[model samples]
Every structure is written in structure tokens, then in C-alpha cells.
Target chain A: MIGWKQIPPGMVILEAGSALKIKTGSWRAAYKPRWIEENCIQCLLCWLYCPDNAVKVEDGKRQDFDYEYCKGCGLCALECPGKKGNKAIVMEEEVR
Target chain B: MVTPLNLKELSKKELRFTAGHRLCAGCAAPTVVKMILLAACDYPVVVASSTGCLEVSSCISTYTAWKVPWIHSAFENAAATLSGVESMYKALKKQGKIDKEIKFIAICGDGGTYDIGLQSLSGAMERWHDMLYVCYNNEAYMNTGIQRSGATPTYADTTTCPAGSVIPGKPQPRKDLTKIMAAHGIPYVAQAAPSHWPDLMKKVRKALEIPGPKFMNIFTPCNRGWRTRTDDAILLSRLAVDTCFWPLYEVEKGVVRVTYKPKEKKPIEEFLKLQGRFRHLFEPGREQLISELQRMIDENWERLLKEEEIFASKEEEKEEVVK
Candidate 1:
């Protein structure tokens, strides 16, 4: 698993450093896409469209996203075609 | 007429554009941009915009509503070009060439923010430049005739993601760009809809106050794209927030707080049903998409609550130590 320390500088890292601050308060939030393996067709669309190379593949199949630098833009879910009977990719909210 | 109580009240009365700007009747972008300018009235603002509906309508070379300094760049490079303008401003400030405090703002559509301009947006935000980036998200690329964009909601029918015999409309959900901006660790990031004028104004003021990069993603409705009534833009914005589809909140210094939480959250269908883009989702088998959308909202609300609890507890601990 890639940790916060593993993120390289100049890269867009999700859930790293301080939470986004506004005038009202801070938000310790992270955007991560959940993969439902049962629904995945091994289409590899999620891996192909991820802007930050956050998704990984194993044995020529889709794997989990490496959140270390995943900006959680939800492009993977947007691009994933395995969303018919069961949505293979879903955007989830995580509190840091 | 009686004099106004504040500058804001007075500025509203003296708009440069009378009423005949080329923007569609229900377009929320023009109003949001006006609000931003009103809030940042303290500084000399230079606006760099992308080739979207807003730019196309306001800037026709010979005639324009942009009274302040402005430039219309390509669809994908407003952020990058604005970064250059900001750098030049800084150098000029140090050399005493430009002594005034000038604010730089980059305005773009969803196509620019989530698709073509994503790289430039990242570059500008990463550089920690003193600027405010506003994404006037109308959900699709309306300037190009209602094409699908990364910001379009799930299951919504667009020209690109149209429902066909083999496939339903846009099968995937909208991109969570707010979370993406927050991950950059910028000083300010928030989502505002023009329907909530007070909230949008407050966030704009806060973003201007921040010394580092600030990003505000505003949900502007498009009558042309969504196939809605021309006068329903404000109503649509209000419904979006009231239904919990678009929560009104802000994140400050790593603490997440809800600015406005509905006492009784309305059904998501109320907001979805108004727009024709989501018409297909109301059909059979597509019911699952609605449930999934609800689940996503619920998940986000739960996470927001947990964040508040953690931060509140930490504050309580600090208070106990003080005692």
C-alpha cells in the first residue's frame, strides 16, 4: 500500500496534507472510488482513464486504486463501462 | 432614490450590462461571475477565461461587458495562462512596476475544468499561486451543443451519452471535483450554487481573503443544456441544495463543516425530474441508478458528520487542557 510518505512532490495527492480550509471550517475529506469486483468485467477502462495513474491492474485484471496520489476525480467511475447490472466503480467519501 | 447602505448594495445598482448580453436567459454563470467581481472589488482584478458559453456571449471583440481587464484564451489553457499573468504581476509588484494589489481569477466551463484544462488547473493550484479558480459547472459542454462532459451527472442523457437500443444514457456518475481540489491542500475550496446567493457571496469573500490558491466550484444551471424553463435557474439551484444533492458547506484548515443542512432533506428525484437530461433514469432498470445516487449522497453526508465529530472532539480536548 502506498502511504502519504510515498507521494512524490509536484504530484496531485488526494488525502494528503491538511484538509481543505474555507472561512467557516476545515474538511478532512478524501475522495476514493470503490470497486465492486463482482460487477467488474475486467474491462480496464478505470485503469486507462485515471488521470493520475491511481488505478492498478493485477493478472491483467482490474485491481484497487492507489489512493496515495489519486485525486478522486471519479473519472474511473465515469469511464468504467461495467456499470450495468452492478456498478463496478463507485465514488465514495472518506473522512481523514 | 434613497442612497444604499453599503458598497455591495450600490454596485448592484450600477451594472455595466443593461440586460442584452448574449448569455441565455437562465444562465447562472454571468450572475456568479458578477458576484465574484463584487466581492473582490478591493483589488484590481484581471480575468482570464476559456472559450465557453460565457466567453462566447460576453466577448465578441468589438462589444464586451467586461469592464475590468480581461482576456479570452483557448478552451484548455486559461489556468496555465493565468498562472503566467500572476507570475508577471508578482515580478512587477517586487520591482515597483505595479504597486496595486491585483487579484487574478480564471473562469472556465466544466469541459475546461474537468477535461481539457485539468492539467493546467493542477499546475496552477500546485504552484500555490495567489488566485481564485471558478468552475462554472453547467454539467455539460453547452457551448458545443449539449455534449457530455466529465461533470455531467450519472445516467443523464446528453448528445454524447445518449440512450440507445444497446445502451442507456451516461452510465457513470459525475466527477467529484470538489474532493479533487481539496486533496491539493490548498487554503480554500468550496462548492456554491448561484441559487444560494448569500452562501455564494460568503464563499467568494472567503476565497478572496485566502493568501494561497482558492477554488470554488459553482453549480450553474443551463436552460439550453438541461431543457428546462428559462426562468427556473434559481429554482433549480435552490432545489439542488435543499435536496442534499448539492450540500452547502465549506472546509477550513482541515475541518469540514456544513454551512446549511436541510431540516428535512427533499427527495433527489425532485431535482432530477425537472431536467430532461435525467429523463431516461426515471424508466425501468434505471431505478437502480437513482438508488445509487441516493446512496452516494448518504455516504457523503455521513462522512461529513464524522469529520465534524472528530474536529469538535479535538476542540473539546484543547478546552479541557486550558481548564
Candidate 2:
């Protein structure tokens, strides 16, 4: 999600903790996690293991990931409980 | 009063350290970082890393793996740098220039903590900096070609102390850096491993809550340096704890508590055999080294138990006096 457009060269970040402004979704190069809400048990293991905190959940239920920040680390997919059979969240190759 | 019922609510509230770093696939440092950051998520944190693998790998030139405010300066002075940062933050907050509660975390490896950065760390802790210092001790100088360090275990092969006919490996026992830090009489000192997430997480929360300098010597296994498969890092860490190679314990106000004790303490060979660094010890005529290693582990474990008992009885006596 962190693209060249959002970041300027010369390492000039004027404000402290300003990284929140930079959408790092563009950092995912090859793959992204595709969530199947129906199959999700809402265990939230994916949320805990997600390095990017990309797995979005609301009201104690699972939601679609915020691609605006996910770096395609595949940790969520790796930890997704549905991997045994349900396949709630799968890493699909990026079309880009 | 509110409590997180499950992992989902917990993540929503505090996900400080986001993933996607260049740390090796199975290395324990990233996990350790994640757990520690999550534990300290209640406060805004400024994390600083010494010139080590975690720094170089995570902060690659322009691209940074850190989601929060982070700084990387030199190999030996992360504590000093963060001390300055904490001092400045305190000053700014007092002057009304800054208004948020910020916690400081200094991260380093064994090379930095047990050797190069000892003076800086001691000075910072002695001066009573309101910071948490974490040493991801992988035993050797893992960032610099796996050279032996002050924290290296005896009879382990390293670049500087390679196993050969002349010498088996490193000649000396590791310095008890945790006890040394405890000697400073800071609020908290602990030894933890990534394999025990709940224990490590608890310690992190406790450390950050304490009002002064706190230190955690975490066993971060290095797949590359230990010459083990990348996926075996966590397994090795668990073995390290079970075999008493890295005891799980904490010291608070001079009170020693052994956090985890294996039901059947696995022999040190169970741990050493997993790594190629100790492969030479299993060779012909070198079986003696294995027993020696076991003897050392047994002695240390016994000493730790005695210390804990002495402190526990002392506390009981104090309570009796109060009654």
C-alpha cells in the first residue's frame, strides 16, 4: 500500500507517527488474501497472526480485508482456520 | 471497566507492530517483536534498535518494516539513543509541546547487550530510564557472520570458535547477563522465549507497567546461524526451555520466579543435537562434552531453584512479621 506517490524522497516525514497517512496496500506485489465470509468461523486467528493487521473484523465478526494496508504477507491465509476444509481465506495471485 | 473477550477485539484495540518484514522466514525475533509490541499497545511507543539483523532487515534503507515510530542508529548504543529520546519526550511533554503518553523500547541482540552495548545499557538502567530493554539473544553475534559473543553457550561452534581437533567450540560458559541486569535492582528482569507466547506476553505487560528500567533476555533462535532448517526455530526454542538450556524465569524487586519448568527436564543433548553448531560434540571421544553440558545445566537449574526458595521464604517471613 506504500507507493511512491504517497512517499517523497529525501526521507522527509514532517510529522511524528505520520506513517498512518501512507496507505501501504500497494506494497502487495504478487498475491492478496481473498476472504470467504460465509465459511469464516470468526475465530480471529487470522487477525492475531496478520503482520499487516489487514484482516478487518467488525462487531466480533469477520469482514473483508483492508487492501489499503495489506502487504500480502500470507500470514492470515497460513493461519486461517478454514485451511483444513472450509478455505475461508485463500491467497489469490494478484491480477496486477 | 472493559476486557477483550477474544482475539478479534484484542487486535482491533492494539495492533501496534504490523508484519511484512525481511526477517528470515522462521526466525523468532519477528514473533518476539509482535508479541512485545502487542503487550505494549496501550501506550504510544518509540522503538529503537541497535545495529543488528532486526534493524538492518526491517529498516532496509528507504523501506521500513515498522508501522510505528522507529529509529536505528548504531550497534552498541540503542539504550543510550532511546534514553535521549525518552528524556526529550519527557521535557517536551512537561513544556506542553507534546501531550501523549509515549513509552520507549530499546531492542538489541546478544552481541549488543552482553558485549558491545553493556556499558550503555547499564548506564541507562542505572540512571533509571523509563524504558524497556529487550535483548533477542540468539547466543552468538548472529548479525555479523555468527561470531562468538559473551552470551554464547559453551561448546558451541561459531565463526570465531569453530569446532576442530584443536578446540571443540567456544571455551567458556555464557555470562549470566540476566542476573547482571538484576544486580542493577531495576524493577523487573526476565528470561523468556518466543515459544511460550503467553508467558512472554505476560512479562512484557508487567515490564512496561513498572515505573523504571526493565530488561528481558528473550531466546531468539537463528536458523541461519544455528545451521538448522528455518521452520525449526520455534521447536528449537521450546526445546531450549525444556532442556533447561534457557530457563524461563523473572526477577521482580529481587524476587526470583521460575516461570516454566518441564515435567521431565529433557537432557541438554536433546537441544544440542538439533543444531549443527553442537554437532561435533556427538562425534567419537567427545561424548564427555555432552555430560559436561548436562552437568552445567543441572547445576544452574538447581541454583535457580534455591534462589527462588530463599526469596519466597523471605517474603513469607516478612508477611508473618506484619501479622
Candidate 3:
């Protein structure tokens, strides 16, 4: 019957500023998908629902993602409005 | 010499759900999946995941992190799929094809468990299948960008139920899932969270040992969906339990026993203020909603204590009869 108020020290207690210190560099490249020019129709679903505003469209056609801001959240890849065979954007691993 | 049971030692050495998977930072589903696997160990387990965050992140057709036998069915059929697996295992055991005891687990999000898959889950529970059902309840359909689910807390903001001029996010309270499972007279039903790792591990072990149906609703924090810091996953779970927003308890043999109760329960605002989902609750005229939420928690806590008292009295009566 451990008392609730006495949270043990070093028990991984989560504080407000804890997230600010975590290095998110590892998560950034985990799912940054590249668009294939051959298959892309540029429906812009990826751009519209970027969540992190990672995707950008040029002249309402060519789609590009700024990987620095992209947390690799995968919303763009999932919500692509392109037809099944003609997907405008496809998830490709970030090239080292 | 005192022998210590290193619970982590009971976990499988093989890494099934490897790191670098595509789940959102601080998503609760992965923790639930990991704990279930750790509890099951190498028991020839086969998992059926619903079409939610856990399924999409772990089994995206082209990329999969699962090392064991796993299947992804529709959003509302994980229970049915696991039931089929259990039936198959039983048939195979009868014919001597498989001699060892195997475990079948169904994993789903709150949407799948409380809303869409409720019928299938109820049917499986009614049939008394030898399967463990885990609901990674992050309170919404997180994979679809935070839509409201039946398990969503009252006044929590979601895409569909946004806090706006007229409405202050979700209007209804969270569905009582543990009571629902207990109503089916299941052998075991428990509510657990990752923040309480030891308690969670103990419940998982006990649930797995039971021969009949077992349901565990695990409160997992969704950093993106809940609008909280990515690192606050464990903290959010702790706050939920401490505020009595999510009581940690287990129901065994139709008797309810609260596993943990906080002393000087923290205010609901302490829990709500951290998450963006409940930000609207702080607005003017929203104090009523907060009070309503507090009243609900108080009522539920009282009911739980009353149930424990009744259970104790019943045990005493049985003891007198035996004497």
C-alpha cells in the first residue's frame, strides 16, 4: 500500500519541461517519405493535412516536404487523395 | 538467501515489436502491445490487431515489426479473429498437431473496444474463449487524427467534437468498459496503466493465468492526439489514476477490488491542464462541466468502495458458514 503523494525519486516522473530536453533527431528521419515523380498526381491531400506543415506544394502541383520540420508523423502518406494505382506521394526512406 | 522474481526475466528474449516502428511519439498502444507480449512470453502466441494505430504502425503490409504470428483484420473484428485462432488452437490440440498450450490475444484501440467492436468483444466474452483482450485506451481514434470514441472522456476535445462556441468538446462521459466486461460474468477484468508498471505487470500475469476470458483496459497517453508533451506519457497516466479519472482496479469472480487509490486526490484540472484536449474546459461558463466531471469521479469512487465493502462482507459470511 504505497502512498500516492510520495512518488519515488528517479522513477521517471514526467514534468512539463521534460519533453523540451528530449532529442527528437532520431524520430525525424524514421518516416520521411519521398514522392516519386513518375507516380505522383499531386492531389495535395498530403499538403493539406501535413499536421506538422511539413509538405509544401509548388504552383499547386509539385509536392515537397521540408524534412527538418517533419516529425515523420505519417499523416501525409496516409491521407494521400491520389487514386490507389496513381498515388501522388509514396513513403520512401530518407536517404543518408 | 532470498530469491527475487525478476519479472522482466519472464519476458521473451526475442524482440518482436522492434524499435523504429512508426507509432507516434508517446503513443499508448505500443506500450500495451509490449506489456501483453511480455506477459505472454513464448507461449506460442498469435495476435490479431484492429485497424488502429497499433495495427497501422506495426503491420503496414510492406513494413512489419512483428516477429510472432500476427494478423491485422478490420477495425471491429480483432476479437472475432482471435476467437477463430483460439478455436483452431483447440482443434489442433485435440488432434495432437500442437501439444503445447498457446495463448491468443486481441489488441484494439478504445474505438474498437468500446464502440465498433463491442458486439464481437461481448460475444467472445460470452462464449468464454481462452483469450486475453486488451484495449489500449488512448481515448480516441488517434490514427485517424483524433476523432471521438466512446472511451473519450467528458469535455475532451477531438476533431469531430471540437471545443467551440456552442459545444465544449465531447459531451458524453467515458463508457464504463470494466463494468461492461464484468456484466458478461467474465472471470477477470482489470484497469491498468503503464505509469504503474509493477501493478500493470502483476495484473497482466494474473490475467494470463486465468483459464477463461480476461479483459484489461490499459490507459495509454497519446502525445499528439491528446495534445501533450511527447515525454509526458507516463506522467499523464499517473495523473489520470491519481485524480481518480481512471481508477486502477481489478474484478475477480464477480467481486470488485480497487488496486490503488490516491491519498488527497489531485484536482481534475491538474490532469486536464496538461493536455490540449481539455483546454476548452478552462473557458468561462465551463466550470459547470468541470464540476460535473468531478462529481462523476466522486460517484464512481464511492461506488467502487461500496462494492469492495460488499465483497468483504460476503467473504466473511462464507467463512462463518465454513466454521
Candidate 4:
């Protein structure tokens, strides 16, 4: 851990988004979502509905899940309306 | 003209409310905060959050999820704090001490806004501060255990008011804080849900644009407090809108407009049954309570529609409304 001396002089938080250091992914007890790239229609509904900004997007397109912060809420899978009737995201037991 | 909300453009903007915070798995506050920041991403924003699940979770001792300037204040004074900040900004701007246009937003939970901070909020709006006050109304005081709040709808079971055989749940309906805020004669006031992002975001943009006090009563779901499925936060919000329990509408300059009217209004049961807080209302003996709740919702919806009709501007007919 960094010393308090390293902190900028302020009553507010030392860093704006220093919460990024906390990995909340371990909050998942049993299940996590497995993304199927081919079925993703990219409507971006999952990204919008995600409680965590786990559904990463790059340059306006969907990217891989950011597991560091994802709590495996599976909202992305629940909200994703993929191509045809197949879902772009499916819940899977976390082997790790 | 309502410029079409492009999801792509929104996605490209830098995230202000980031992840790794300790909000619950399916907590709706994070999504709500993200949407608010995304809508006002064009302007530099300073957020003041009250002592609730949002502030404590997002801003732990040494870490913060907010990229924008953020301050955490007492439970009953977020509005007061932000309004003071806005007043200072005005004073500074007059003295040529500050130049950049900065937006002031005070975020509060239902407990803070509806119950604890109501007077502070009312006073700030009355003072005509240039700021936007957003209350993430989860219906109860979820932060300090799920206790009944002034915003808790009738018949819902909270810790303080449990739904027992004799007592049932909370006997009285929620205080209509939206109408109360609208009565303040502020420039903008709206009620929105996270499920309808486009409508919600558009309201945020509009609220920020208008100079003066703006208040948005956003009905965000609290999965932990409501005992809902972790993934059902957005779904429940959508059902709330469709069932007319939490109608999406805005009061601009005292002229009311119902933003998204359900094509076919659904029964309140659809919205109630999903949450454990309202589970006791579904029992055999409590069936009458359901109908009573239904009637109450229908009455509320009618009243809102009537308000919209009465205060509707002369330019647009009552039937042809913005969807």
C-alpha cells in the first residue's frame, strides 16, 4: 500500500477512479456469463443495463467482459437479445 | 426537435461512474449513475452524493469510482451542500475567478431525498439554485437496513413495516415527492426509470440545459432491499413503467407532459409479484389488498394523465404526444 505522504493534499479522494484497484469479480458465488461473439447483434442493450461496467466496449462496439470488476450479475445475459433466438451470453459455472 | 439518441455515440464517451465499486450484484444505482453521467458527459460535472448505499459503496475510504469531482455529505443535506457549491460557483464566476461551465448534480437515495432531505431539497429549489438534484428512488431506506421510507409505496413490506397477518404492510401510500418538487415551480422536473434509457437520458440533457433548479425522481431497483433476482433490476423497472406504477413524465416550467404512455396499461400485479417486498400481498387473504393497490395505482395514473392534459401547452393536442 502506498503511504499517505504520497497522496495529494486534499480532503477528497486522492485519485478520481482509484476504486478500479478493487476486484469485485470474486463476488460471484457459482455462475458467470460466457459470451458468444458470433451471436452478438451489438444493440448495446447489455452494456446499458449492466449494473457494473463489466460489459466493455471499444470505439462504439462491444468488447470482452471486464472480469476484474464484474460481479457475475448475469444482467448482460438476461438483457441480451442476440441474433435469431440464440442468446449472445449464456451463464456457466465458474470452473476457477 | 428530439434528436435521436445514438447508443454508439454514448458508448464512445468516457465512463464517469466506473466499476469495482461495492454496489450489490444487480444494484440499479450504478446503472442509474452511469446513465446520468453519460447524458451530461459533454460538460464538466461535480457530483455531491448523500450518505447512502451509493456514496459509501462508490467512495470507500481511499478509493472512488467517480472520475468526476465528487463529494460525500450527510444524509439530510446533499441538496443543501450542492446548492451551496453552485452558489459559490456563481459568486466566483461573477468575480471572474472561474470560467468553464461546470454542472452541479446532487445524487441522493430515496431515504435521503424523500424522507431525510425533503426540506433541504425544497429550500434549495426555492432558492433557485442552478443545479440538478437526482433522487435514485428505490422506495425504501435501503442503506441502513431496508426500512420504510416516505417514498415506499403502499402495501410494500419493509423491515420497519413488515407485512404480517394483522398489520399487513405499510398502511399508507408514498408521499408524492414529484408533485411536491414540481410545485416548487422549478424549471424542470421529471420521473424516469433506468429501463427507458433514451427517455431518461433525454430528460437529463433537457434538465441540465434549462437554467435553474431541476429535480428527477428516478425509480431505480434495489435488488437486495427488494429481494429481487439479481438480473431483474431493469426488467422490474420496465414492468413498473408498463403497469403505470412509476409513470415516465416531465413537468417543464409547470407544464406537464407524459413522456411514454403504455399502449395498454397493465395490472399492477405484474410489477408487484416480482419483488419479495410485495410478496405478502399475493397471499389468499391479502388478495383484496392487491385490488386496493391496483385501484390506487389506476387513480394515480389517471391523476397524472389529467395533470398532463390540464397543463398541456396549446401547441400540441392531448392525443398527439411525444413518445
lDDT of 3 by residue, A1-96 (tens): 235556445332233122223223356654466776676665554443343334555544555666644566554554455655666666666655
- Which stretches in model 2 have alpha-carbon errors above 4 Å? A1-96, B1-6
Tens-digit lDDT string for candidate 1 (B1-323): 43222332433333322222356533667667766665665666888888898887765434455666777668888988898899999998899898887888888899999998898898899999899999999999999899999998877788998876656777787888888888888888888987566677788778887898888898888878998855466678889988888887777766667788888998899999998887777888778878888898788777877877888899889999999
Quality class of the docking in candidate 2, CAPRI style? incorrect
> Residues B1-323, candidate 3, lDDT per residue (tens digit)?
21122332432144345444467744556555666665556466777888888877764433455666777668888898899889988999999998987777788889899999999999999999999898999899888889999999888999999999878889888889989998899999999987776688678778877998999999988888989865466678889999999999999989889999898899888998998998888888779988888999989989999999999899999999999
Model 1 alpha-carbon drift over 4 Å, by segment: A1-96, B1-19
What ranges in model 3 sit over 4 Å off?
A1-26, A29-96, B1-12
Off by over 4 Å in 4: A1-10, B1-4, B313-323
RMSD of each: 21.3, 4.9, 16.6, 3.0
Docking class of 1: incorrect
lDDT of 2 by residue, B63-174 (tens): 5667678877788899999999999998999999999978899888889899999999999999999999999999998877999999999999999999999999999999
**Residue pairs in candidate 2 whose N, alpha carbon or C atoms collide under 3 angstroms:** A1-A23, A1-A24, A1-A25, A1-A26, A1-A27, A2-A24, A51-B19
True contacts kept of each: 0.00, 0.15, 0.00, 0.79
Q: Highest TM-score: which candidate?
A: 4
Q: By DockQ, is 2 or 3 better?
A: 2
- lDDT string for model 4 (B73-180, tens) is 799999999988898899999999999999999989988999889899999999999999999999998888999999999988989999897678899889999999
Best by lDDT: 4
The candidates' DockQ values read 0.01, 0.19, 0.02, 0.78
- Give the Cα error of residue B2 in candidate 1, in Å: 20
Per-residue lDDT of candidate 1, residues A1-96 (tens digit): 346577556333233112111111111145567888888887664543343335666545567866654555455565466847667988778766
